[model samples]
Target: MVLLTLWLTWAAASADTTKFDVQPFKINLGSEIPRLHALVNNTRLPSKALYGVGQDKGIELDFLAELRREWLEVFDWEAQEAELNRFTQYTAEIEGLTVHFVHEKSADPDAIPLILLHGWPGSFQEFAPIIKPLTTPTENVSFTVVVPSLPGFVFSSPPPRANWTVDDTARIFNVLMTEVLGYKTYALHGTDWGSVVGYSMYGSFNTTVRAAHFVFLPFFGPTPEEIAADNITLSDVEKVAENKGNLFVSLGLAYRDEQTQKPNDIGLALYDNPVGQLAWIGSKMKLWSDPRAGTPPSVLNTTAILTSVSLYALTSSFLTSVWIYASNPNGFSTTYSQAPTDAPMLFSQFEYNIIFYPEEYVKQTTKNLVSYKVHDFGGHFPGLDNPPALIEDIREIAAVFVR
Candidate 1:
């Protein structure tokens, strides 16, 4: 991302804001909410440009062609769509923007109230595979899950103005939980952009959020000195936040830069070439997932990788996802911007997508952090990769907060 001079800004103040007033649908017996019937029409990615992996990216010719062919043949957008709409969804207005979300309530009435937020190029749809496990852990800790589409994401509308940073979005989510759902106290978690939003809410409604759990939290808390008494080993897996990440982002972050600094321009091309889109995205999955371990397309084949990777693409969320970068270039501005948005004050190293933070440097940053939990196996998309494990982890974490 290394483009501090620029970060994705919300749609220009001057850009037209399309307003759609959606009414509520009776989703659950007593928990009905408004559903937006907004339809997007202006998208038209350049068919040819999308066919080629950016030559400048230096991808091998064969891989690029393979990427293109697979996208054209293997990826099925229609199936992805039907799979998504299968859930009960709704859209609501917040802060001059319409937000789209999928709400899944657990049968356990006493289940903890929780909300899941997604970042760029990802929609609520990504959580589908893991939904059952998380919502009804072992059919035990049931949760009324609310997964919201970040503004400009698949189902949500873009901002009418600029300056929609993590704080801005988190503020809205806070309202949604307390006002809309009437849950004054709940758990908030997120991935990528959702992580950032979760961070903001962690403080914005610190009194309410029981404890925030993020698979990709960037900010630092402890120094080895502080946690030395407890003695926790900071593994490369944990340091993946530095760049290698649990299973994604570093290699593909450059694309985030282009979106931040020149999103409109990037979008102009990506909108058309679904092939190009697949290549750009596939390249990241290649680098993040063990290339030597799995098939050429590990993300497409493995359940977790496939679920996480395919989450948004199936829904054509790329449009709204990139718009986040296009709108707030600053958030995704650093090569390491992929790092945590929450740790503004922590002296962190090898942070996000940009310049590699190196192993030792990352080791230095997370030394003393308390409440630091590390896991094995699950990559960028733990929920998709091993929902049962993630669900167990969440259940354990939530036990402290649930009354």
Candidate 2:
């Protein structure tokens, strides 16, 4: 693994420039689209059903029907691309790979730098609302927020070779922050799969990252009590978190299993069938959403969820990311050998997301532990669901380290 990092086995990719660009930079609706109008009209979402009135109720029977109609009829790739391109985006080669990212900097030159990392089936679009507040804190946080489409996702190029892993990505990011932006230190935040990316940033180059925060705390080790007691303490908590992954043994590790094993097969499916893609991601968005919370605000809007995911999905990088998983099963697994001084780290255990009891995980890791706060609001995709609460927590925790 170290060798892969030392000598870039990864190949540098030149841009995949296409001459035929979509005018208006949006996907064009085909001539046949109007025919699907019947389905679109047939699928009407009733006002109050399934979780009701505007909150994330399970796509009302009517809405689902509409989703079917719209999806079958009006789902336009160009529209989403236009919306995506509206955000300032750029791609650059780093560490032998094409990396795509968005850098929304606060107008204030003095604002701190914060890197927001996204997870699997997710893209930087998740950070849209949260970015403004972070970039303008007080008034706003006033930080330059950089959201990157991890290598292999969307605009970014694929992993140079089969050996690239999270550590390499973190190293490349270190270059992005200090070398690219010239920030001696910056706060880092990530969710879901990105928890690993953000965490690895500290581990890969502890000296560079000032602080790191994660909405999803990923650890594949024993709990702290287990470590201290020197006995089997079990995970000690149950998160309703079930996915197509947990549906079966291999399924439980579906993301991991696929990433490690058959990433291409999964990616091919996501690309071939939009419905297949929706069911795969939509199911989880539904599961993570609290029926009590009404319609799980942050994670997705079933159809809109596809936007962020499809951004990555259409690129075919989803398969590459899966392969990364297949390659590095223990990518985020923290052990003694590759430990760093615990930088200030905060892990918000969304009431609904998995909580392996991070405080316990903290005790086991070898970092100069700072603080860890388990928040009550927002699970998995905190950026969209609970921006205000996330804003407050980030402000409080980030203040301690930024200074």
Candidate 3:
């Protein structure tokens, strides 16, 4: 009887080792880097714009040229890869798909488990700067950080079937934290499309997703008329944010529409073309980042931009990464419904996020609103635009809710 029980234990462990092997990962583009350089060298950009050239005209011709030169001559993918690999990373089969993630466990036994998600045009690299800070022991608190490459992005496998949604990804991640990593309850922070998936987990997996923090949400806040009717006055900063949002709707939605309507076209066109990928992805990275980047606290710079473009180009996942837009037409247009969770929720609003959710409208979506901080800088990508503030905000949330 004792032999039978021992055999059963060995068999279970063996199955787990074979089927759900979580192995260390290293970023090795190998020959892809040289090929990428060749592509950049051979590329022919449009003759510098003759007239009427500006931000409204789309990515500046001169800027694209600069990026092309940097890609061929200055950008070092190997160095960037080494920097990224400094964190503990691994790949495991989750939900029958290969999932790549950075799992940095804190030394503190009671540290909070926190998952950070990234969105389109961004990869797991979005949270790279904050991983060490979050996991290191601090006077306030620390986190056992889990940063995953969203399905169809970077190292992760693309969705195996059509119509895969953020909620599906959320379920896989929940299983990863609870069953795979053995964390019964975890906290999460998300931005851009990450917020969409994080919201799903916060609302649906409330039993395990104990607390949450977000820089963006999937739903639209109250319309201007609704705000006026409710007598909700907008602050000067908020008014500026509202104007920027209106600009985004009018001028910035072309990429969204193309990705939504013709995912295959853009995907295939830029599949093997590294320069094209740089222009397409770099434009957004440049435009959406804090305008004051390169200054203190905002780390968005040339190397960061090139590294992002390289990740998409070298992974060969550029084509599949845009699948999120096409898969869910209403992904970002979700009506403001109450997030069905009593877990404490916190938000950090950045000045240049393209949209603003007034505190009143934000409160309407959740029962437990613990914190809402407004920063004077930072754009859509807070981790890149304002890493210090972003790090501080996460620490604050963990101290209050996760500790």
Candidate 4:
């Protein structure tokens, strides 16, 4: 009787861990490419700013014009789609929402399961470069990489109702990792809004989420009192990062505020306007990255930028994607929990990112911080800016599992 009870318990647990019904997906922009080009060709550019201070005013007229010309003349959506299809893509229904993701399983049977999360104005494309390397078995480690498109971004469906907070996203993704994919344990890495979701999982699903890594930490800004505390001495590098962060908060929060407060307004306005979508996301791609990040002289490669903008326009996800900010307006101000999470945490700080968290601030916010790294190059989108470094950092965090 005792043996039967134990067997039943084990059977139930195994049954609960069934693999998700994930269907193969491919990006086919057959007619959409020509349609996009037509819109780009028809777009009427505003006159060049009279007092042109360059990017300060917004995406430069000449820059937009050049990009428009490329979109209309040189950019090939079909080719780009084919390249994107190189990775195995799939969509699974989780809580009535269709979740789109790339699941690149490592050849090694013992590979670590790792989920990579991306933020707004970015998608699973952000992790394209690192996917192969992470999947390739190294002497020390190998990873089965899963990159999910946050709901309402690209292929993923929008929330069934409005006001889907980061916490909600975390819950759905937990289902994706554990229940659907049948991973008993996994690690997470994220940037921008992705970090918010990853943090949510780390805090809420401690039993399954063993470790997490982030390039961005939402709602973790240091208080004035903490900054002014006598024990903390600011290094020159730290001071520069702090000053840059302050400047960004003062000048760069307009987009965030608008997105959070009045998403429908902007979403409606830019819903059908492909050029408008381009300008909205393109400016950030140009400004937020390290100038020295990409293969092109400017950090924002024209082709890459266009690819991201096209995805938004093609899928009509701009409005719903921006709704994430509105859903969690108080997220940045609200503490995730009363105490720090027990799950091991790791953070990577880039110098030119919009916001910078000093080592002290990160240490204070994360209780079980196993690693904190500062890179000379790279920005908010470190995967695109410096993928090798990002991969290496992920490996460093993964080391904790073995230890």
Arranged by TM-score with the best first, the candidates are: 3, 4, 2, 1
* Higher-TM-score candidate of 2 and 3: 3
lDDT of 1 by residue, 197-246 (tens): 77667656766676556555433233334334545555564454433442
Cα misplacement distance, residue 279 of candidate 1 (Å):
2.1
**Candidate 2: worst-modelled 10 consecutive residues by lDDT:** 13-22
Q: How far is candidate 3 from the true structure (C-alpha RMSD, Å)?
A: 4.5
By lDDT, is 3 or 4 better?
Answer: 3
TM-score, every prediction: 0.67, 0.73, 0.93, 0.91
RMSD of each: 12.0, 9.3, 4.5, 4.5
The candidate that achieves the highest TM-score relative to the unseen native structure = 3
Off by over 4 Å in 2: 1-66, 73-83, 221-251, 292-299, 332-338
RMSD in angstroms between candidate 2 and the native structure over all alpha carbons: 9.3
Candidate 3: residue 394 lDDT (0-100): 88
**Clashes per candidate, residues 3 or more apart or on different chains:** 33, 19, 0, 1
Candidate 3 residue-wise lDDT, 1-403, digit = tens: 8678556433422324345678889888866887888878898987867674786567888988998888788888889999998988888898788999898888766578899999989998878888999998788588889999999999999988869999999999997777667677889998989999999999999998988999888976556777789988877777766666667766898999999989999999999988889888888888776678767788888888899989998888899999899997788863787888888998988877866788887787798988998888888888888988998888876655642
Per-residue C-alpha lDDT of model 2 across residues 15-127, encoded as one tens digit per residue: 22332111122223334335433433443445546444431323335544555555655667567666656566666567667667776767655566788888766677777
Residue 280, model 4, lDDT = 87
Give the candidate order by descending lDDT: 3, 4, 2, 1
